[model samples]
Target: MDLTIHQNCPSCGAPIELHEADRLIRCPYCEVKNFMVSRGVLRFVLPDRAPENIERSEMFYAPYLRFKGNIYYCKGKHQKYKVVDTTQQGMNARALPPSLGLRPQAMPVSLVTEEIQGTFLRQTVKAKTLLERAALLTVIDSEKIKAPFYHRAYIGESLSCIYLPLYIKDEILYDAVTNKPLASGGSAENMRKSGSGYHPTWTPHFLATLCPQCGDALTGEHDSLILSCHNCHSSWAEQQGKFHSIDWSCVVSAETSMYYLPFWKIRVRSTAFGLETFADFLRITNQPLVIQEKHTEMDLVFWVPSFKLRPSTFLRMGKNITLRQAKIPDGEPKMVQRMHPVTLQRKEAIQSLKSILAGAALNKKKLLPLLPDLSFQPMSTELIYLPFSDKGHDFVQEQTGISLAKSVLHFGRKL
Candidate 1:
């Protein structure tokens, strides 16, 4: 059964819509608050367990000898299965206008055969590779993982989309001169009342009391969770949930904010060719294969795998620096090295390695047309307030987005 009630907030005596799971309610009218009952009496559905004795296999795509396109299939089920990348885009020459304040000149656009072909292969293989990778990583406690279909006869059945809650504390601004904090709070409220006694941090008035710059009160007519100091003109925002500060210091501000972020982890089986096709492909590609280098102790080679399941934008940049030290032959590092390392074998390695080399020369402005095919669903969100103060004059909000999503989108642009 479900329950609902209209109750007055104990702190502000304002009308509030109460639910079985609600522990506290805020009063917009009186700017007060109240406590709700039945916080522990909420109902919930159980999670499904992971499937047992699941069969896995190797997956791959082989380009045809002629113009017949390609072939896709899976290897036999085995205890171990690996992922490989085949996308490749190598560096090439391009015509550019004169530098050093010279006049612009018109020139014909030329296509680089090798770069284009490699980029095309990378785009084509990505969609299928991601699907295969997701299927392989799906091994988890079946009870917690979610699947669309469900039946008692099924060994593992779970909800497909689960809203996992989290806490995030983002600091917008830290005063350079004074040690005072001159920013708005970006934390959840529920977790704040978990304690008793007159806690100074729990109350908004305490943290928002003084301006970080001028050390003035932030009192205002706005009842919204976020407010700005009339003296500094800096504002902040927050939601009603649990939040905590991990570490507070002059360098960084850490706080906890509650939120629901989504993700899907799955496993799958795939196959690959048992033989090598070309050695040049191996040299330019980052695919996993054993290689012998002088003065090197290890004989084995491996690549890390990664996934951007949702829609995303990928931008590559390439730059040639004439180092003072002699350059090593055939030494091109994969861009995935910019992130945490994971297992990437066979085809996945080749593809990721190729993409990195292709865009190694991309500048901040010219992203070219290959910037699409890279996007993902939102993992988390937070409403943050940045602080700014001008000594004698008013301050203006920075030229970026006031929200996190927009800000990320802006910076995620080319380069």
Candidate 2:
């Protein structure tokens, strides 16, 4: 019996057939890509769209809404009410080091701010700031520039930073909102104790750190405390009775921005060759075995930036269009020549990408050959923030609005 499964491109709606050794597959339709699976209890499917909101242009440039550390006034462009920045070249190509004479790069500073306030361990933590993303290399040939040593001047190719916004929801599990953790699980006498601090669990919109020892997942329990491991046997608390390595969460500061980071998916084909020969004195036996190795040319797809062509902050329509269709004004091209786009939730997309990198490291394989091993295909999607303001906006409500708008507008566009 022959087993043939019909598959369609998630982005452009192209018809495709499943192939046995074809781990990485691209759609002929819209260039939306996907991964292949041969067996096992496969879990997790990549989303077709980003789950967060684009702010629908409601978040205007308001001095009253700005925080002290915002990079907006000095760094970004103000378009109407929204703060805007556009990329003229492909981020992938810009990743190349200018010092190496690979490509030209631009490094921009950040501007935006928000106030963060919350209680962790009965103590109040208050601060005002914006979020920023690390400066990264944007290369034209993502496949060629795998190592940093190849780049010339690192400064030019790297991006400055983006200050994005996030929402945080918290829950208190203690016996009383005013009582300390000792009071919740302690004797009645503990309730009368003085100078006791309340214990609360904090859940942030995005995750930034992980436990190094067991690779167990972690979450911020409070402004100062972190719930490191979900496994009970795991050691989360240090000698100081606090989670270790949690200070790393500071990486996602208010200066963080949504960027058009570039990446390359590579494909390599190889064959085996030659044979081992042995010489013996008695009863010489002859063996016939020849090894052959064939290396196939690498195929690549550069991950590029995706923006709605409409004036609206959200994507309104299109089932099919050319490569020039879904882009922001004066947008840049991806560094890599060929690429497959996949639409995935922000969280899942990052996770899947990380998994590919990690798996490649452990398996001693290059990413180019591991393209087919990826769980989801690539898509042009935005990495955006829910944007929170202690003064006016509720992140929850904003996220809900964004989700509703995306579902309605995703499939309604023209190519």
The residue-by-residue lDDT of candidate 2 on 359-409, one tens digit each, is 212222332243333343343333221221122221111211221233222
lDDT of 1 by residue, 186-257 (tens): 322222223122222212221223444566553322112222344544432222332221111011112222
TM-score of every candidate relative to the true structure: 0.18, 0.16
Query: Each prediction's Cα lDDT score?
Result: 0.22, 0.22
Q: Which stretches of candidate 1 lie over 4 Å from their true place?
A: 1-7, 17-25, 33-245, 248-415
Candidate 1 worst ten-residue window by lDDT: 154-163
Worst 10 residues of 2 by lDDT: 61-70
Superposing all C-alpha atoms, what RMSD in Å does each candidate have to the true structure? Answer: 28.0, 28.5
